[model samples]
Target: MPSSKDAVIASLIKSFEAAPRREQPYPHWYLEHCLPTADVAELTALPFPAPALGGISGKREIHNATRQYFDAANMEKYPACKTLNEALQD
Candidate 1:
């Protein structure tokens, strides 16, 4: 069985991947703003979307909101999975 850390990591990766690719203002904002808070050198080593989202730009508020969304949704599944599915349920 996958270790808890591995499960969490896999879940996180899956959550990220399963997320809709269609760009939204919120994610775009996170990509822009939160990236700076991430490691610059470390981010540079990654590729594509990771690098894109890992660098600084703008939209910090939006990023926070996005995080909140995830936190609400995956409270059970991941504790911070975001309630995107719930939002869609409405």
Candidate 2:
């Protein structure tokens, strides 16, 4: 059986190849359930960094919102997140 990672890569390739190439009224495509159920759950469970909407208003809220992105050291600490990142890169 193909590993989950392999399955995801295959799915991505298939999705891209099968995507409509012709110009339409509006260009758009969506892949439903692209990731496996477990991956979806894992990704969903991750604590996403809150958007710094207030930053747009010059409230200095961007500091807190963007902190998570600059914390690269923590990325390797979470195995699930690391794996997900690798999968995305593939």
Candidate 3:
């Protein structure tokens, strides 16, 4: 059986691979732009906590942190994100 950490990493990879590629009507533009430039290899190289078997907090933290990084990097482009952010901010 794979160790817990291995299983977690595998699951994360699977989830990313399985995520649908459909575009959102008003997509998160920062994410859309950043993904092509984002270094998945570098990200996977970072040390992260082993995934929790039952709790979502671990995954949530990873997701939120990545979002924050993308948001900060793309803040200047927020004007372009008008439609999506407006709906989200309300």
lDDT of 2 by residue, 7-87 (tens): 666666777777666557677765555666666676666677566464365556546545554134645655456555566
Candidate 3 per-residue lDDT, tens place, 29-71, comes to 2222222112343333334455444544545555553343324
Clash-forming residue pairs, model 2: none
Error of 2 at 43 (Å): 0.8
TM-score of each model, paired residue for residue: 0.25, 0.54, 0.24
How many backbone overlaps does candidate 1 show?
Answer: 8
- Candidate 3 whole-model C-alpha lDDT, 0 to 1: 0.38
Q: Which stretches of candidate 3 lie over 4 Å from their true place?
A: 1-3, 26-90
Q: How are the candidates ranked when ordered by TM-score, highest leading? A: 2, 1, 3
- Model 1, 36-90: lDDT tens digits are 2223333343332322345555876644533423234333544222222332244
* Candidate 1 global TM-score: 0.25
Between candidates 1 and 2, the one scoring higher on lDDT is 2
lDDT of each: 0.36, 0.59, 0.38
Query: Which candidate should be chosen as best, given lDDT against the real structure?
Result: 2
Q: In model 1, how large is the Cα lDDT of residue 63?
A: 49
